[model samples]
Target: MKHLCRKVVAGIGIMAMCASMAACGGDTAADGVDDGSEMTVEVFDSLANYQGEQKGWFAKLVKDKFNITLNIVAPNVAGGGSTLFDTRSAAGNLGDIIIMGSGNGQAEDVVKAGLVADISEYIDDTEYLKQYQSAIDELTATANQESGVWGIPTSVSSLAPTESSEGVEPTFGPFVRWDYYKAIGYPEVGTLEDLLPVLKQMQDAAREAEGTDDIYALSLFKDWDGEAMQNGYQFPAFYGYAEGIGYVLSNAAGDDYQSLIDEDGQYVRALKFFNKAYQMGLVDPESTTQNYDTMYSKYKEGKVLFSFWPWLGQAAYNTTDHKEAGQGFMMLDIDDMTIASKGAQPNGTSTFIAIGANAKNKERLVKFVDWLYSPEGIQASGSQTNGAAGLQGLTWDVDEDGQPYLTDFGVKAVSGESVTVPDEYGGGDYTTGASQLNVSTVLNKDIDPNTGVAYNYQMWDSELAKRDTALDVDWQEHMGGARTTMEYLESNDKLAVIPGATYSAPDEDSKISAVRGQVKTSVVNACWQAVFTSSDAEFDQVWADAVANIESLGYDEVYQVDLANSKEMTAARQEVKEQYESQSQE
Candidate 1:
């Protein structure tokens, strides 16, 4: 855990230092610096799990390249609430590096309070960051009204702003255990309601085959819930809608918005779906009390038969051994469902990365941030999450034909196998040793210049040629020879790509904010209660009571404001889409 500070010196001094270090059998740093000054940069990351000094191969990489050490401070892992963030912000400094969401008035509040440094002055000095100038500009305009570059948006894409970023898989939609689904004879799921019977059959088959009474068709958690039951909110995405300002669900095509409590809206429909599942004993009874980690553990244990996102069930269940055995989660077609997907975000994603205004060694911090956007940095830092091949020389390398291919160790590591690293590369478990920053500077599906293919290792020709696992082959065969889920969805016109745009809702006044808080609490509680109701009568009564309770709390006034904001966001998205289309035509 030695932290080093970089120093700028004359070319001759740098040469002398390198010569002296060489004479002493020491190697010069990757960036050609040989300074002895030491420093540790504190990073406040909202998405990270590991806290304290970063370790293993990722630590070694950054230490050698920038001569610095990263000390992570993760509020999510520390206390499971915002206590750490509130205290740190009140103390006048969040951290040297801050990663947070751009929603909920957070980015604006930080900018107005001067908690984050304005990076406009240092951006031009970055070598690789210049390519994302447009993304930075869009974020500045939306968050600060173009006043200054307060923060850089994460996951900026190289694709056109109008194109979806979904490659082989999507972030939303239903995934079922393929083996269980096949056991039930691949019944047609014509609508959301039809899925209940299918899932029940799959669950029964699993229980009978495995001789376990612990299996459930659905497992959910409440820790990630905010304004509403997040699990219920996910259903709307299955039918081409996403949560808008507050209490409203907007279409992915940016054309319409509706109140979440609407009698016929997707949100209510989702609540009914969950209630039916509960009535059939298909839902995990502990869902209301469990956290994400607990629910995920169930998935890993093969006790869950359904998942709402590919990332969740797939990551938990799709081990190499499971796939070879024709067992894993696979996206299932819901005839009435139109999956909501996001297009390439030229304006960047909702997450923001910024430097604290009170941080020391500001110049070095800027250099470090800039490196995160570089190709090499993207490869190394994004390896675990973004599906990028890791650490060029060790995990992957360019072949004789100049195409990137994963090394044998890389294949094993990426496939979730236990592989020991050589001591020179910071030996440890590959997955555990990954960088814990939990943020992406560029989209993984974007093309990598060196390979003429996407940064996702799955998209590489070499990897694709060998990707025919038994589970994959079975799923493809059942889907009429479709190679991937995205392909099947697109061919069937079941995907709705939301055009990317940079927009943040205006800050709510004190009265509106208060009303929103009360209404949200009431709605979220009511929805969860309705799901666990003993009968359909109780479910109906719960909804009626929730509607009356929220109305009494001035829900209508807040709804109007959110509705207006939704319209404004839709208009902004349309404008961005038109601009991209015009540029392409020209």
Candidate 2:
């Protein structure tokens, strides 16, 4: 209901340049006036079904320690939400610091608006920020562009790549519920056909048990679910085209030669599969209207046997308080939802952060930002995940009534003004909850992912590791939808080759989005019809025909653009990796 974009004008930005070939070294320190001037940082940090909130944490710390006053501007009080920040920037009424998400394709807009500083020049300045020369350089090079500095990478986490298990049968590879599958076990359930016979039997079992027949597999969110509505410009690498993080890149080369969707006929195959699932009655009937809570509930109630989700979705079940979710649900990756594993690798083009134009204190904001990247800062933010961190803004053991109990403000609601938390730490700009690690206080108490990892850090990493082993077809290479990728496709035709996509202003961006909004719904509708029917040739044709019309309408040109962008990505990643390897040499 509230938007934070307002008229954000000039403030300090960062710029780092190499001092000399010989690396002169000196750290920059801030000289605080100790004026204790209170700085108000209006942020977006709400946690609800509709609106996101605004917050200031380091601001709280600054307010608590220094003479500076930290005023948090909420949407209700300011008469403006986050989007108002953009509007105010045009009207020249922004705050000192702002929070921006990295995944959205508007970094260029923010940069052009001059709402953020050009910090690119100071990326290598050791005096202002220290201890991560290698990592810092990597961030800079990745954002390198002749056009602008745009945004810097924030948050930090890196883990050693675990050895890929080959001989071990991937736990997710196809399946039949062992209980009902024995009599007619098709022996396996991974490949497309390898799953059919068992699905038919399951359908029969459901019909026989209930007498009133009609069963389905894979659940769908009513209308459009999981961000399918967002990809109004270009379809994403996956099938349903959901947003947020996913495995999309091919490899270091980033060519996308290894595709989940066959370069030529990904849509056709996807449609066919939707039809196949429909005919088999493997999809859940409620999938079309189920929210996440509903779907998980169905799984628990035994309403449907199998469906697709992230590997640790079972963990979300969390049998008891303080107990892990998905602890009991066995992952069956085979027939439920799967795809070719030998596809492109998805890179970390995820959530990022930027300062607000209205931040009350520029110096404080910089200091705060630098602190977050520091080992101490990374440790602080990672703790605020999975309801473990104390109250949102202020986590405490003491309540207002002098009760020695937690006066919680809801974890996600408490904090605000996040810098982009790196994928290595936690996904996106999640700067709350409490560190996912439990440490011995001396070490800032955050998880050090290198050797002695913490619980959540290991949990996420373990989840990523199981990706190869679990193989939910829906999540494999491509599931379905045109979330962010559609937008990327429409605006940046060049990116189809890789490194760069042609740019468009926000107006053009909106028009393209409108076009995609219509197309995507058609896709979901086709899927709804196809999957509802028992697995059959007739149902499969309807699905295929739908894809054919979509392809005829615009997919060919769109896909060509993707090819070009894919090529460019290959070139860009190669250049960066070469530089990263050289810089990482210690």
Q: What is the C-alpha lDDT of each candidate?
A: 0.80, 0.36
Q: Model 1, residue 402: displacement in angstroms? A: 2.3
For every model in order, what is the number of clashing pairs? Answer: 0, 138
TM-score of each: 0.88, 0.57
What range of 10 consecutive residues in model 1 has the weakest lDDT sum?
A: 1-10
Give the 10-residue window scoring lowest on summed lDDT in candidate 2.
159-168
- Give the per-residue Cα lDDT of candidate 2 at 460: 30
Would you give me the overall lDDT of model 1? 0.80
lDDT of 1 by residue, 440-548 (tens): 7888888888678888877678876665899999999988888878888888888888888766667678899889889889988988998999788999998898888
Clashing pairs in 1: none
lDDT of 2: 0.36
**Superposition TM-score, candidate 2 onto the true structure:** 0.57
User: 1-586 in candidate 2: lDDT tens per residue?
Assistant: 2122211211111111111210111111222343546544544321121222222443344445443433434343454344544444544333344443332234444443445544444444533254433333433344343433333343322321111111112212222232333334424555444555666776566556657554344444553232122111012322222121111224322423422223244433444555566555566666666676776665554445444332223334323321222122232323233222111111222223445433344455556556444434443443332213322224333235422222223222323334443333332443542322121111121243332433222223332343332223222233232122212222322122222111111222444445445545665566556556654666656656866765665544444443455555445445544544454585
